[model samples]
Target: MVIALPDPPLLEPRVLGVEDFATKRGRKYGTVLVNAESHGVVDLLPGREKELVAS
Candidate 1:
């Protein structure tokens, strides 16, 4: 049987906060940036380097 699903609603764009945590896959380490206000991710940066602040 085929099931039809409704499309998800779009989120309004606004100022987003970026955060990082410890992540490892096998022997690799990385960081992930996520939005503070909304339920979304901004980007994924390589290594556990310091995060830059944007004005």
Candidate 2:
């Protein structure tokens, strides 16, 4: 028997974070991290808001 994996969860547009931002910006994961570090933007991982702030 074989099992199939479910599709990834659909994310909204207003969300901000590394993966979402990367997908929106069409950038690689590492590139997003580097740009965020250089620009002082929070490098937020999914569901983790340690460095996020209201803008």
Candidate 2 structure quality by residue, lDDT tens digits, 1-55: 2357775564333434443344546443332222432344344444323353222
Model 1 clash pairs are none
Residue 54 miss distance in model 1 (angstroms): 8.3
The local lDDT score (0 to 100) that residue 7 gets in candidate 1 is 52
Name the runs in model 1 displaced over 4 angstroms.
Answer: 1-26, 51-55
**Which one wins on lDDT?**
1
- List of clashing residue pairs for candidate 2: none
What are the per-residue Cα lDDT tens digits for candidate 1 across 1-55? 2357665675654766555456454455556666667757666766665533331
TM-score for each candidate, following the candidate numbering = 0.43, 0.19
- Runs in model 2 with CA error above 4 Å? 1-3, 18-30, 33-55
Top TM-score model: 1
Give lDDT for model 1: 0.58
**Candidate 2: Cα lDDT at 44:** 47
